[model samples]
Target: MNFKEQLTRFPILETVAKAAAELGVEAYIIGGFVRDLILSRASKDIDVVSVGNGIELAERVAARLGPDVFVSIYKNFGTAQIRQCDLEIEFVGARKESYRTDSRKPAVEDGTLSDDQNRRDFTINAMGISLNKDTFGELVDPFEGVRDLKRKIIRTPLEPEITFSDDPLRMMRAIRFASQLNFDIEPDTFDAIIKMKERIGIVSAERISDELNKIILSPTPSYGFKLLYHAGILAIMFPEMIELLGVETIDGKGHKDNFYHTLQVLDNVAQHTDDLWLRWAAILHDIAKPATKKFDKKVGWSFHNHEEVGARMVPVIFRRMKLPLNEKMRFVKKLVRLHLRPIVLSKEEITDSAMRRLLVEAGEDIEALMKLCRADITSKNPDKVKRFLHNFDLVEQKLKDLEERDKLRNFQPVITGEIIMETFGLKPAKEVGIIKEIVREAILEGIIPNEYEPAFAYMVHEGEKLGLSVQSTGTTFE
Candidate 1:
């Protein structure tokens, strides 16, 4: 197949062709760039495969591009990359690979373009468009990649087992591509994933988590997760999530399958926002249910304090998954802990103090927390869903109203520990912390406005109760 018009759209390909011709080597725009071009997906990354040294080709292309352009070379891997404005083009030599039993890293040797395409993980990604002057847009697809693309299938060019076994990370990539493009894996290929599920243990946690995050960010992320679950990959990669799979029944009552519920919540959050951490919160909001589940004759089943337990589990899970344990981790943890607070408020009489406390605790993340909570409503009963949604609207309105009256979104205590220490002429002690907490609580409870004067006055009174004499007046403390 020729895509001359499409190839013409990227004038940089002409420079690549010129560079390859000067080096007297066959070069083609291959892999993801070719796949996305056929699918009409906008892509900024281009992979160029050369029959000779890829670094030389990159150098020539860079020189042709201009003096300002820089080509980054990795001689050990026989690859080079050039950044041109918004576009990133990578150059690599066509090579045949032989993988060891223990490692995914391949023994590389320069070969023909056919050898390169044969090693591709998926058919759609194996297609390449020649960059020669005579065959400018000719696709070299021995594996019928275009047909697979038309059929919307993910199939390895080589044997599925061999492909996945050679680089087990390709198993995750297969599922990721299927999820990202909403394509189906070929039956044989999917089965191969199931058969090779254990091999994924060889892949690093960072690589696994990277693919998992991509799956989470997909339009319908639950599809990818369901694939992982069905293939048994989730069992090995994320046992915590897999533990949410089945429902336990006692007597005539049973709880919902939390695994599917989590997927539903994740899908709902995906519709509202693309924040990966928010979606992560949805996945983990009920993660500790299994640990905290208790059976009672009257209540059937209850997961008491699962939210707090799940919040504590967040750091451990993130560390295990090789995800960053920074502010993002804290964000997920906070959401998990407070996820039930708004739902509880909606079921009960909404209070100003409750709203204030939620606002104060959630801070800038209150809106995100609300989105996650809204997504957590996954009941099958339409009436129940409708009633909960209505209550949520009411709760949101109250939050908005209260937030306007008292700007508590970024609420912090006006009285600092330093001020407390100054007021009592005390060093860093429990008395100072106690006074600060009292003032903070008073403001949050609306007993005193979050201001310097009233907070200072309350701190002074609290100091007296704690048997700490106020050595200085309000001015001195202020």
Candidate 2:
């Protein structure tokens, strides 16, 4: 049961022990570092807890480690952090915390190591390894965190209700940990989460979004979403997503549950790529289905233009959740807008012109869009899924061939409005626009090569048809 051998791997732990012994303080490596060490997960953030002044201990440790080690101290929080050898070691005094009902912030007071462990959110993180000379590397696991680690269950170190209620953000952390480790939430702990779901409102949106991102990055994000939904957190924090839940039947016809469909798409996308924004695209691809839904005797149920509608919703969601509204937001929006195009193309015949427009619009994101489309094919019928995938293969091959032949992506027709204006002796008029559109369409439809010569010739012809004769010859615009 001695992890002293394992502790020797990090020389900094020894330096910390030496420093704490000099200061007559009890020091332990606690929280995530300990949990990950036992689980064999790679972790660089080390949480160090000492029963005496943490900042002073860290300063002494930094001095003992040598001049190269720099310690940053936050006096208000009674914490110190040292960045050494590509690792971040955070130091804090052993303490207990009591919180007000309106806030997650705790009134902290110095306490024993046991009190500190009791204040931890989950059992796995409650385990600590002493870093004192007397007991260097002896584990202090009062909550049997080793058993929970072996069981692969996430449970509170204390009563779940009190643990999560003290810091509602812990509920989000619990779900995130379950998703990341592919572990189960203990029934009582989960029930406690359901009982205290409303407490999450006191937590900040940014914190919730951080946990949500971790969940989305998990191997099976659907697990986190399902837990959030069933436990009522999603309804409180993400009502829009919750609205995607249920199917309404009219005249005995019900549409597929868009909520589960979204989760299936999310899982499928997760299997293909670890890109967080792409996973978000899958989450939001049909987000507007509920809003755009209609029932018709002819079509049973329809969610027409959900992609476009959903794309518009992305910015609002991002703004609300405090997610970046930069190009990342645009990427997710673009994917959502184009998610159905490839699917529709697969269902119908794939055409060069359709592929050209898609290539031009999707530009650099065409591949990501196609990946999302394939993941969106979540048919319960295996044969139907296979057929759609095969059709998608054809569409993909066609795209590759088109891109290889024409280099149509990010392509503008060689004929430009400025050239049309100079050649046809016109200002920026309807004739110029007509000529440009005609040549652009001709190149896309393969009526002419994407080269300058044919496009210029076609532009002249279109201009002549518009009752304008070429007054001067001009070079094609770049």
The numbered model that scores best in lDDT is 1
**TM-score of each model, paired residue for residue:** 0.98, 0.95
Off by over 4 Å in 1: none
Residue pairs with colliding backbones in model 2 are none
Error of 2 at 164 (Å): 2.0
At residue 23, candidate 1 shows an lDDT of 92
Q: How much does candidate 2 score in TM-score?
A: 0.95
lDDT of 2 by residue, 203-314 (tens): 8899999999999999999999999998999999889999999889988899899999999999999999999999999999998998999889977999899999999999
RMSD to native, candidate 2: 1.9
Lowest lDDT block of 10, candidate 2: 469-478
